[model samples]
Target chain A: MAEAVAGCVRHGLPAIGLWRQNVAEQGLDETVRLVKDAGLRVSSLCRGGFLTAPDFEADNRRAIDEAAALEAACLVMVVGGLPGVVPGEPLGEISRDLPAARERVAEALALLAPYAAERGVRLALEPLHPVYCADRAVLSTLGQALDLAAPYAPETVGVVIDTFHVWWDPQVFEQIGRAGREGRIASYQVCDFLSPLPDVLLGRGMMGDGVIDFGPLTGAVAAAGYAGDVEVEIFNADVWAADPDEVVATMKNRFERLVVTRV
Target chain B: MAEAVAGCVRHGLPAIGLWRQNVAEQGLDETVRLVKDAGLRVSSLCRGGFLTAPDFEADNRRAIDEAAALEAACLVMVVGGLPGVVPGEPLGEISRDLPAARERVAEALALLAPYAAERGVRLALEPLHPVYCADRAVLSTLGQALDLAAPYAPETVGVVIDTFHVWWDPQVFEQIGRAGREGRIASYQVCDFLSPLPDVLLGRGMMGDGVIDFGPLTGAVAAAGYAGDVEVEIFNADVWAADPDEVVATMKNRFERLVVTRV
Candidate 1:
């Protein structure tokens, strides 16, 4: 976490998105102090959802408190896929009731929205791609995410527009417009979807490195009234193995060439 | 193809879906003779569309003729994905315009629907899973396929409801209902979507082995008034490598246990 903060400073990057694990490893207070000392803004806390888990409420409460302490824009929420799917455990008799799983997410939000609002932390719901619907996230489209967030105040609950997750959606552009109209566009994340992927979870590519044409997506976000810092979120194995400095430099260059000009 | 017909007869299965490659290798007329002699029905032809390819028109017209000769229910259409993607070739400079790729499908249907109708064959547009949106088929949702079919007569243009493709869609049930109303449910293909897929193209599971609950989906099909023969379309390497007799027996058992009872 300290190295990430220092890297942001060294690379002249203005902000960073902090994952909860990294935050925990460095200790929340120390991590906050490091980012503050480095004069780097916290873009958003990495996550706070996984509503299907046993200790969801307590864990999410702590996540909200951390986001509040960091003064991040919003806490990214990755609503869990299925019930009783513990990390590192062998997947057992899986529940096939997707609608019921989604209902759990809605119920979780109803309970958490007020608490998050009190803490001034918006829960940013991210709709992962449908490929991840069985194992990673049940929310598979921005439209569905918007529907889930409808009951809460837009200030308390918002939806994320991540290119890698949503580029294949038929209704993505229209959903972005709806998000703008509802004032629920919380964060804009960019990454390309590379095919012949080595690993499904870690197959995201840097901007302009794959098949996504950024001009139209960025244009949609801009037209939808999103005036926020765009974040790069690549999880490719090759990218992670590369030198961090080079990765940072490449992402910035790609973002400028492929995203910024269009936006 | 002859062996498949013999196996279907030996297994007491009444019908079979034939792929073009197998038919080509066996000689189309010989395939027709073989199935006829074996007293088996042809549920549907495996494929017909690749609208973005250079020889699509000629190739698809031939596929329609083959389906007609085999007396198949529909000519399944797997619309081409991005333009200029050739099989077994290194992918290079892919066209990222998905909307445009979809428009090409629409245009191709407009041209072929009349021809197919005249030949007493329905062009069944199979909306492949969105995971294949980049390389296999641009038609990723039944709704999109329905929209493309709206211009033609319902008997002439129809959409396929493949479980592996449309199961994850948020609006799948509603769209299935809509397809029923439109009289566009040409075929019902079943295969489970297994996680940690070995090869995305060939990772389909047998019905009872994966996370899909056959009850609601089969119930939906029955409610939607589809009385077509349900086809098994597993593409798994293990299933392919297993003894054909054992594979057929397992599929029959699973179908009875998981799908037929539900319906």
Candidate 2:
């Protein structure tokens, strides 16, 4: 973890996103001190939105605290799918009440929004691809996330516009425009959507490794007035197998060529 | 093909869906004659909607004619995804012009609709799940199918309401009602949606085996006045490996308990 902070600092990367597990693994305070001392901005905390989980309330409360402690821009929330969810396990619904499940998210948001506001942390609701609708996240589109955010102040509840999740949606550009109009675009996460890929949990490819024309999407994000950190959030097995140094180098290369170069 | 028709007759199953390939295998006229002789009804012909295919025109015309010849109620269509699709192959794109690919479907329907109408066939458009969006059907919602069908007569371009394909949709019930009100529900296909299942070609489960709450969805379709054939279109490997008689028997049991008995 310290090496990651050192690497980011050495490489002149101004920001790095933090996964809570990684933070916990390194001792949250220690990890925070390292990144803070190394002059790195925590773009966002990994996640805090399994609203359907049994321990959702306590878990999310801590997530907010951790994100606030790190002074992260936001805590990305994957408002989880069916209650009884385990990756690779057969999708068994504890309740086939999808609307109620969604209601739980809004309901949870209402409870957590004030708490997040108190802690000076924003809840970044990410709309996962619809393929993950059954098991990962029920929120499946930027527009829907914006709708969920409408009840709260934009700062309290904003949407994360991940390129991989929204690229397939025809309404994406229009929704991004709406997000801009509504002041709801919080984090602009970058990834690629290679096809023939199922909604396997760890199936994301690097920016240029897929068929996504990141040009228009990134353009839309920039046009949306999003001047924030663009996190390279690839989750492929091959990428994971590669040396961390190599992955970092490749990520920087792709971000430059595919995202920043366009900018 | 003959055995399937014979089995349907012996079991007194009212109608059987036919794949175009099976029709071709049996000699189209011979299969048509066999079904006609057995005093059977052809509920629907399997498909005719690879609108992105170069030869989609002549192929769909032949499909329309075959459905007409079989006296089928509708010619089910899986509007082909990404131009030049070959299922199970790496998701290749002839062009990443998804909108243009969809436009092609509208254009092809414009050409095929009149011919289908002339042959007394309804074009049943099936919206496969969004997971199949890249390489299968871009039409991922019943509403979208209906939208496409709107520019043509409802009788000429009708939308299919398949339970498995649409169960995850937040707007499914509303869309089904809309499909019914528009009088565009040409087919009401039923199956299960057990997730953790990737978007593999034959990954579908039987009616009762999945997480799908058939009660509400089936009730919604029934409420929407869908008095059409309820086809069980499972593509699971385990089910396929079972004895043919056992499969049929289990299907009947599930169909009665989960779908038919609901009525």
Candidate 3:
């Protein structure tokens, strides 16, 4: 947690997305203190889902409490997949009832939304890639995310646009525009991939190295009037093993070279 | 070449997509004779284009001749990329002038179309996945393919829908429907992938093993009124290394179980 915060501070990155494990490891209070000291914004708390289980009430409330403790701007929910004792596995394998699972997610979000709003934390619904549809998020498209957020006030519910997950989407620009117009574009992440990829979760490229035309993509988002900080989130093992300072410097350089120049 | 044709015959698959090298190895006359003997339809010949180059007229003409000789229903084109020659490579890198390349493709197709029509072969415009956008087909979507085919008649030009390249698209159904309605849906290929995949070419899955809902997809194509063969074109090394008979049997079973049930 300290390392992440320090990296964000040294890199002059305005904000950072935090994983729940990092917070738990440092103790939420210490993590929050470090973030405050660094004067960095919490773009979002890493995640707060896996809510499809039978005992979602307890898990959802705990996520809310953690987000509150961290004073996060939004509790980014990686909504759980299925309902069962083993909480993290996808819900589809055992249950054929997708509509019911979706309803369960909505209910969990509903329960957490008011608390998050009370605590001044927005609820950001991230539509994961379709690969995770069965076990991670049933909400697999930006259109679907907007549809999910349609019933809620923009301040209460919004969407996270992770480039790695959404770059392949033909409707990305249209959806980003819709989100901006509707005031539901909560956060934007930037990452790249050379597809027909394997182990998709970890094989993301470092910006320009992949085929994604980030220039046009970031431009489209900004054109849609999104003013949020661009979060550089790469899950590649290659990047993770590199010197942290070098990685941060490279990202800063790429951000200016690729994103700022285009937008 | 003989092995591939024999495997197709033994497996009872209605059609087989043949690569150009395999066709060349068997000699065009023998290849045609073998395919005829086996009583299998030649779904689509695996190539015809690298036309982004300055000296592609001869190669393009040869490809057309080869397609005619092989008796392929459709000559599937994987259009070439950038203009410069890469070191240690025979062909040059992709050109940045996408519009010029598109025009080149159009010109080549126009010249070959009449000849192809005479030989009773169709020109199938296969819009490759975006990852190949730099060096492969700039026609990366069905919409793009249709747009390219707009000036040509359906009898002269059509689009090939390879599910592996297109299933990630949210607009696939809409585009497939549009293609069918416009009479541009010429060939349909089925293969699956678990996204965040590696080796974009060889990572393809057998039907029903990956994320694509084959039943729904094929059903949509059929509903759009396409009475074409569902070619199971898998490129997985796992499946490729297995006994050829086993692979065919598996595909046959999957076609009946998943595809037939849906259609």
User: Which candidate gets the maximum TM-score versus the true structure?
Assistant: 1
Q: Rank the candidates by lDDT, best first.
A: 1, 2, 3
Interface RMSD (Å), every candidate: 2.5, 2.1, 6.9
* Candidate 3 per-residue lDDT over residues B1-263, each given as its tens digit: 88988777776676788888888888888888998888988878888766566676776566667777767777887766545523224332323344556677777666766766776667788887654554566566787788778887787688999887776554678889999989988888888754325454675788866656666678778988888776778888899899988888887888788766442
Clashing pairs in 1: none
Quote model 3's TM-score.
0.83
* Runs of candidate 2 exceeding 4 Å displacement: A91-93, A260-263, B91-93, B261-263
lDDT at B19, model 1:
97
- Please give, for residues B177-221, the per-residue lDDT of candidate 1 as tens digits: 999999999999899977655466786899976667777888888
If you assessed candidate 3 against the hidden native complex, which CAPRI class would it receive? Answer: incorrect
Residue pair clashes in candidate 2: B81-B136
Query: Which residue runs of candidate 3 sit more than 4 Å off their true CA positions?
Result: A50-61, A79-119, A128-141, A194-199, B49-61, B79-120, B127-144, B194-199
Candidate 2, number of clashes? 1
Better of 1 and 2 by TM-score: 1
lDDT tens per residue, model 3, A9-34: 87678788888888888998898899
Cα error, candidate 3, residue A211 (Å): 2.7
lDDT of 2 by residue, A1-263 (tens): 88778889877899999999999999989988999899999999989998977779999999999999999999999999877876578655466677778888888889899999999898999998877776788898787899999998888889999987877676788999999989988899888766667445666788876656677788888888888888888888888888888888888888878787344
lDDT of 2 by residue, B145-233 (tens): 98999987888889888887888777788898998899999888887776777545666788877667787887888898888887778
What's model 3's overall lDDT? 0.73
